[model samples]
Target: MIADPEGTVLALFAAFCRIGACIMVLPGFSSFRVPVQIRLFIAVAVSMALLPVMWDSIYPRVQGGGSNYLLLVGVEMLIGVTMGLIARYIVLAMQFAGTGISMAIGFNAAPGGGLLEAEPEGHITAFISFTVLFVLFLSDFHHMVIAALVRSYSFMPVGADFDPRMALMTLTDTLAGAFMLALRLASPFLVYGLIFNLSIGMVNKLSPQIPVYFISIPFILFGGLILLYFGSQSFFTLFVNGFEPLYLGLP
Candidate 1:
C-alpha cells in the first residue's frame, strides 16, 4: 500500500536526526544515570509520534536523496544540538547558583556525590539542584520541550541553510539570561552572608580576646538555615516561573 517505502524511511530518519540529537543532550533525559538504550528508545518513539505531523515538511526535502540529503541531516543535527544545549546551559546556570548559595550560607561542608551527576557537590548545592530539577519535571518541562520541537520546524525548516552566527548569538543570549536568573536567585543569600560577616567582624574587633570568628560560625549557619527555610518557597517559585521565559525566548 505504501507508494514509496524508501522515501518514507528517509523521512523518518530525517525526523529522528533532529529529535534524537536533541534528546541526546536534553537535561533530565540526557542525565548520566539514564541508560543509553532508554534514551534511544525515547528519541525513536518521539520521532515516530511526530513524524506524521511533520511528514509534509520532511518527506519533500528527503525525496531527492543525494549528497544534499547528507548535508540536511548534518544541519538538522546541529540545530537540534543547539536547541538542546540552550536548555542544558540553563540547568548548568542553576547549578552554578546553587554553588554560590552554598558558599554564601556557610554550608561548605565536604563535597559528596551529586544527586543528579557523577561529580561531588556540597549538600546545599546538591539539594537546590535536585529540587529545582524535580520542580521542573513536576511542571511538565518535557511537555514544553515537545511543544518547542513541534514549533521548531517553523523557525528552522527542513533543508534550510544552517546559520552558525544566529545559533551562536542565541546561545550567547541563553547564557546571559540564565546567569542573570542565577544571580537573582542567589542574591538574597549573598547579601545575608555579607551583612552577617561584617557584623561578626565588628564584634571581633570590639572584643579582640574572644574567638569571635569561630564562635560566629554556628550563628551564621543557623541564621542561614532559617533564611533558607523561609525563602525556599519563593526561590523555587521564581525559578519555575523564569524557566518558561528563558526557554520560549530561544530560537
Candidate 2:
C-alpha cells in the first residue's frame, strides 16, 4: 500500500475527475432520468477500476502540489466532458433525425415524457428513439465507451496540457459528421414529404373545393408508417454501425 493515504486519495480523485465527468454525460448513464447518486457511484467504481493502471502516471503528478495540480484536475475534467460531448452529439443527431421523421410523416404531437427529457414528440418518434437506444445497449456499446476511455490516457496523457484547439477541432468534426448522418437518416422522409406535398398541391389546383390536405393526411400518415415499419431494422442497424467509428474517430 502507498505510505501516504492522503496523497493516494487525492490521486484517486484526479482519476475520478475524468471518469466521473465522462459518465455524467455519456449516453445511457447521462440521462437526467438516472438518479445522481447512481451515476456518482458508477463513476467512483469506474475510477477504482482504472486507478491501478493509471496510478503510475497520475500519482507522481499529485505529489507535486500547487496551483498546477488544480489546473491538471480542471483540464482532466474538461477533457472528460469533451469526450462525453463527442458521444452526446451522436445521440443528438439521432434525435434530430427522429424529429425530422416525425414531422415528415405529420406525426407531431404535444411534448411528453422521454428517457432524456420531456419534449415534443410523436409516438413513433419516441418509439424509434427508445428502440435505437435500447439496441445500442444490447450491442454492448457501453463497453466500447469504456474501452475508448481507457485508450484516452495515451492520447491525452495524465498531467499533460490538453490543447483547447484540438478539443475545438474534435468537437467541430463530430458535429459535422453527426449533422451529415442526421441528414442521411432523414433524407428518405424528406423526399417523401416533398413528393407527397407537391402532389397534393397539384390535386388541389385541379379541384379547388376538395379539402386535399385534410384527406391527404391519412394517406401520408399511412404511407409513412408503412415505410417506417419496413425500414426500422435497417435504420437502427445503420445507426449502431456508424456510432463506434464516429466515436473512435482519428485520435
Candidate 1 Cα errors over 4 Å, as ranges: none
Scored against the true structure, residue 212 in model 1 reaches a CA lDDT of: 87
What is the per-residue lDDT of model 2 for residues 68-174, given as tens digits with 9 covering 90 to 100? Answer: 88998999999999999998888888888888988898876675777565565657666867787789899998888888888888889878998999999988899
lDDT of each: 0.91, 0.85
TM-score of each: 0.97, 0.94
The lDDT leader among the candidates is 1
For residue 198, model 1's alpha carbon misses the true position, in angstroms, by: 0.7
**Clash pairs, model 1 backbone:** none
- Candidate 2 deviant stretches above 4 angstroms: none
Residue 195 lDDT (model 1) = 96
